[model samples]
Target: REDPSDAIVLKSGLHLDKPLDILFDTKAGTIGTSSLRRIAQLKQLNPEIKIQDVRGNLNTRLAKLDDKNGDYSALILASAGLKRSDFNGRISHQLRDNWYYAVGQGALAIETRVGDTFTLDLLKPLIDLKTTYECLAERTFMQQLEGGCSVPIGVHTSWNNDNQSLLTLEGIVLSLDGRTKVQNKMTIDLNERLVNANIDDSSCPFNYTDIAINQMSDHIVVNKLRNSAILGYELAQSLTELGAKRILDAIKRQ
Candidate 1:
């Protein structure tokens, strides 16, 4: 399975050519954020090409692209959905890794109404700690940056399982015209994050039975979540200082 964030899917047997109109769904928040970046990258390669807003579900969008009635040379979609639908073979281009994906892309969310303790309890065990940490960082970044679903904000996060569990976050904000862009990256040590949470490293007993690390799982995970949020807020602040605030404000005005 490939990471589908901002990936391009073309008509079968067709390859990318010059001056193509890339189809994307403006209704989906990710399109506005990532498509703009893709458009910028494409312009760098071929200035004549353009991006078109197309609205529909996966099947409907695919139908339009297959029929070629929308004048779209290719369609860009999240690889996660394509792969989940067993359509990985249809991907023509994976896009470049340099492109940041929509915050929490490819991850699932569990939402429970207020006072719904039953539902919350049911979902607790299903939570993926690493994914939770990453999503928290991303969401915090967006929150601190005052970005919304419609804003052109993007992020990518990774959990390193090396010497100490390390969480790295990379984020960006791009102008609507795909011209101006601001990006930043940050990393934090998950263990130290726990220590900062008042969990004494020397006193804490960690069971190394599982390589994935389940020692004091709940405590470590909770602290990791907190640390991730702080990291995201800090990174967003860094980007703001780099002039992302201006770029974001300009996009909002448009």
Candidate 2:
């Protein structure tokens, strides 16, 4: 299961309805967008509210938030991380609306020596194939676009497991100031591709072989993966055509 992207953790007794100052870590692009988006939205409502950056691990950050004398009235954090640290109670609001998650956010990944069948076998049962497919599309989009921490790029993906599994991807490129953004969504019927590739629907969880180890080969399943990745590449191309590249390029010169 994918965890929610990011959330607002307020000081004890603080309310979301109340005006407040916010704190966030600015080093990581994923969390940086969270802060910038909130700042942009809040500026429209409470022009005087403050936002500042304070970097630390989950525990250290929690210590800062719990300090009564802390300057920040609230904290923006990954809901998944907060929960993992056993501080879910501090989360007052999950930020999703008008927010696109970082590519592959909240998804777990394990990397081992290539061709390590032992590790692969151990991890195979825990793998969520649907999430894998979704993340693959997002990562492919980022890789092809050459997205990096400096570029404010994000994506959200959903998989519908109906009679035909359909994958929907929404991607965005934003200006540093957060005042401008280009976003687009695309959907592809992945089940159709799998069917055409002769992959059985009964295979509830596709074997890892479906993923091309390095590049395309004789495996029919590899084509299915390639098609799914192509969907993302196509979406990125459409967004670039709609001026995403210009926006990204302008940001880079800064």
Candidate 3:
């Protein structure tokens, strides 16, 4: 999050209390408008705040926050980054439920040249099954909307860990301005066949990949995340139809 100790007024006739975090790197893509709303709320609370622009890669951005000179107070990077760089210790906070993260932000992806079964097999165990499936739903939702990095979007997935295991997905889209947002949620029961695949010895066998997904679905905390994504998507769609485009157009113009 940016901390402009200075204050600036917005076109909306609102004043910011502190600097707001608005920039999404090319790597993180365009974040959904729902995230922007949170920043707006902060502004509403503190009308004297200032907003500024900052640009850099993940490591460079973090360095700005940790700079001994105190040029910055905090930095917000994707949770996935810490895992990728093995820098989990650097995460000052984990905004898991309240802040909707980018699709596949904390997950790992494996890409290989075509026909590389050897490498695929080597990396197969490293894959997280739940993360894969959840990401699948998220990516699918985003792709269906014909959106790219610039689109404001968020998604989350979870599994029902009751005696009957089921998969649930939620997605959100938002306009560039903080004014409008949309969200959606869906569920699927994977208990019968999906669970069996993990338990059966004859099958490929379930690994941490599978376990992580199942655990995520079954976990109580993830339930809120699932719902948040759903609400966010519905809100985004509605906002888009109701003049979100105008706000975005203005943002682009500026």
How many steric overlaps are in each model, in order? 1, 0, 27
Candidate 2, lDDT over the whole model: 0.63
**Better model by lDDT, 1 or 2?**
1
TM-score of each candidate structure, all chains considered together: 0.78, 0.76, 0.54
* Cand. 1 TM to true fold: 0.78
Cα miss at 75, model 3 (Å)?
1.6
Q: What lDDT score goes with residue 84 in model 1?
A: 85
The residue-by-residue lDDT of candidate 1 on 71-131, one tens digit each, is: 5556777889888888887776676467777777787765556446567667667766777
Best model per TM-score: 1
> CA lDDT, every prediction?
0.64, 0.63, 0.44
lDDT of 1 at 186: 96
**Best by lDDT, which number?**
1
Relative to the unseen true structure, what is the Cα RMSD of model 3?
11.4
Off by over 4 Å in 1: 1-4, 16-47, 161-164, 194-217
lDDT of 3 at 56: 71
Model 1 Cα shift for residue 81 (angstroms)? 0.9
